[model samples]
Target: MSDVVYTTTHRVVVPFYVYAGLAFLVATGMLFTGAAEFSGHYFQPHILAITHTMALGWGTMIILGASHQLLPVLMEGELYSVKLAYLSYTFTGIGIALLVWAFYIFHMGWPAKCGALLINAGVIAFFVNVVMSIVKSKKENIQAIFMLTAAGWLAFTTLAGGLLICNFTENILPDGSLHYLSLHAHIGIVGWFLLLVMGVGSRLIPMFLISKYDSPKILWSIYGLINGGLITFIFIFLREAVSVLYMIPVLCVTGGIVLFGFFCRKAYRQRIRRQVDEEMKISLLAVVMMVLPLVFLIAVIVTLMTISADVHMVLAYGFTIFFGWLTAIILGMTFKTLPFIIWNRVYHARAGTGATPVPKELFSSRLFNIMAVCFIIGFISFVAGIVISNGIAMKVGALLLLLCAFLYNANVFKLLFHKDRML
Candidate 1:
């Protein structure tokens, strides 16, 4: 790796963080307003709106931006085209704003349909750009393969979502819309989010730790288990199969999680750097959070097998995956990666000529610590409220989460406006 590996300009990445910040702010507001009733049902209009805001607006948008910058470094090549990156971002940003607005109003009209189409188009643009970049790159590694595969899953997920939106407007699905929602959710969650995190984390974690740990075999196994499990899931889900067969996908996903845990442990044990930063600590905590879903999934499977599928357990599982694990990782990694990009832009020219603040100085660690504590407390209280059906606890949790979001935005602005020579 080089001192600076980002080939994409700051213009490409900065707007994404801006969009993500706005999305997080909006999501926090939704949670605060609907806190008392958010856990009541997963399919409510408000819930759907908030979920898409988090998933597409906050999560997918940031990933797309970061991937454009990181993929070149991972593949040891330059980006194929910056214009396509801008187009992808524009389409995705506009599409998500429209889609979330439509969902918030519980309207399945032309606006929502058009939003879905725009989102699908944006995803297509992204997929084409990434695939072409990989093809022209000199490096052909497992990390690139993981990214390419995740891009495929993203395309499929978007297409499925677009079709679902169309079905809402035109009643195109032979079955109910709810049946396909699960498929769409899983494809986005497991196939796209989980796989991308694992793929990217595998490369970045060890690199950050300054450890010379490499395990191609373990990574290969992790890949096989996840893809195999997802394929089996798609088949069963599409066929509408019943029985214990659904457990197979759950087990495969769990197996991947377990293997990843081991992989992280190996990386930690072999790490040369003794002191890990707060950002990395939060990211490592996310790795631990990944196991919570497995536990919830077990409960979900058990309920399905014995009595009935419990909506509460299902909600818990989804919540753990998205908010607990995925959100934590993204929040943590944003600080870890974003500072470097900003640093390169601000201090690259001043290197050796004068004293330039390091990337770590771009933001306050104390603020990050506060945000982390609030996040964990808020997440736990919210989940507990859901489990116990307590509205007060949920409200408290939402308020705390809102505070965390505020702190997050504050720190982000601090970094964005950081001066080379701080007083």
Candidate 2:
């Protein structure tokens, strides 16, 4: 059998990585500079700008690029159109740029709407390409099915986001603009980003470790629970149909988590190689990190029951979910995924032919361990600062996070720069 050849359909993916790296810089800068607390501005534009930059420009951009590369492998078919991938990237990049500018300049009119429209188009284009490709493929894999389902959620995410932009610019809704904004953000997070990443992880993590554990049952369970929760959430929260309907989403989300935990346990048990790599270890920790938010989430619900939710509590909630859960998973995955991508593109062709060394010899695991510790320290401290309302702690935590970011980046760079030397 021939070795799998990984080739990105669009070159835009590499630029997205560089852009994402810069986004980390800006986000860290805001943290150290205390820009989260603007002078006399509760709604800090600087914070908003940085937050959106990381979410849209960095996280989503990389996901789109990776999806384009993986769709063919998962579906057992060539991508329907590489040109469409390029088109989507261009539109998405333009949209992200405009949105960032609009945030900085507070231009909530045509610029915001246009940006939203562009992003929507990009998402639609991506969905069309992937869905059509899957339909034509010979193999019907569970991972591909999960991906298609995730694409449907992506459509809902973009639709909600587009309406949110309209709400930001004008009054076109019944309840209020903030209501829709909340709806849109959660849908994107829970439905699009979290759901899709988990779907992919269920496949890649086991395969990378050469495990034969099949997770189709768990995948289907998670799929039903998440979408069911989201549907119930929209009907109850957005339409204001029933106050008690909030419980449906909360319960379904919990069910999804339970199913995922089972899948992880099964994979760990079934790994052919008993001794896992550093990336797997870090990813395991990330799986544990998912529970942190559920704790805070339950607290938030209780607090809302007793009294009106405080703004600081809301801030803490956001910080915990975005930084604690999402950042941890991304940081862990980056170390593993980036190395593989680099190995495939730069080193794979030369390996086993006396032309290159193994990819594992390129990096220092000790360095990665140190970086992981610092990151965890920083992340915990940052969340604590928000809860305690300590600006100094937040600043220090941000600095630590910045250090972790640089270290991780350096580790990856070392592999790229020293590939030939190791050989």
Candidate 3:
């Protein structure tokens, strides 16, 4: 299949992009305000707020939006229900606002509960939409299956998150929140975000590079390893096994990551398009960004093996995954995807009639470059601050990130409100 998907509605898709851009801005601002929180435990109220904003508002929302558009393309069919997609956005947007507010205030009450419930409903709606779309198409692609499984995991993640919030007041979990927190976080991180990335990235990176590499068998194996590792983790957590056993799942997932890297490498080596652009380069760097989390995870593992697990090390791991890997990929892919979507919207009916602005004209490369610089500096500074327990570094990093967020939002709006101009 070609890399163009025009099935989803502009109204449905654009709001998600707008919301996610605003979310990144809000999340970075929150991190700036709460930079002091990084010096302490990772479970602080503000920290929780920032995490959800990054995860739900910025990352998951974009994925949901993009998937709605891409799913039909993957299956070579139209989306089963655009109305359900709209439903998802409404419920999810409300849930995220309510939940973020509740967490910031540390209010683990009805608002939080209701927020969680609403998010759960939203994810369920999305999953139903996905399943029906895929079923109706009656076509199976490993890439689409990856999306399907990720949706299922997303449902579980929201459900688990709700239970965790409920456990703040009620005694629902047998083990404490900390023990369950690892399981909950990993399910969303690896299962939902990472799995989806690997799947979608596998298809997109190669396609954009104009590579002839396509291996369904290897893709299936990678899928199994990731899911197998996650399922094993759930089982071990349920059994309350020793900490060392967690390594089993870790190793399995790590193996999958390695294979994915190799897959991307092969695609790059065999690419037909030799002149890679800045955006493609940034997306490629996300492959390296994945290592940031793996390094921190190993540190956490070694610490657990030798001494007590350092909370700061754990914080670094989570931040690297969200900000480092996920954010980099999103920033890069946003340019790649959003431009085309907007260009199509503007020029689909006017194609070949006259001179027209290409997709890249919808946004500013200069703005994106400045944003990338801020992301690099800010991400490094904040991570270093967490390591050395320095508040100033964290603040500077967050401040830069805030600037980065502004630039991102600026570029996003530029594209969203783009006008037709022939050169």
Report the C-alpha displacement of residue 61, candidate 2, in angstroms: 1.5
- For candidate 3, give the lDDT: 0.91
> What's the C-alpha lDDT at position 224 in model 3?
95
Q: TM-score, each model?
A: 0.97, 0.90, 0.97
lDDT of 2: 0.73
**Span of 10 residues, lowest total lDDT, candidate 1:** 1-10
lDDT (CA) for every model shown?
Answer: 0.87, 0.73, 0.91
lDDT of 1 by residue, 284-312 (tens): 99999998888887888788888887888
Candidate scoring better on TM-score of 2 and 3:
3
Residue 111, candidate 1: alpha-carbon lDDT: 74
lDDT for each residue of candidate 3 in 38-95, tens digit (9 for 90 to 100): 9999988899999999999999999999998788888888898989999999999899
lDDT of 2 by residue, 344-399 (tens): 66765566777665556667788888888888898888878777777777877888
Query: What local lDDT does model 3 show for residue 380?
Result: 95
Q: How many backbone clashes does candidate 3 have?
A: 0
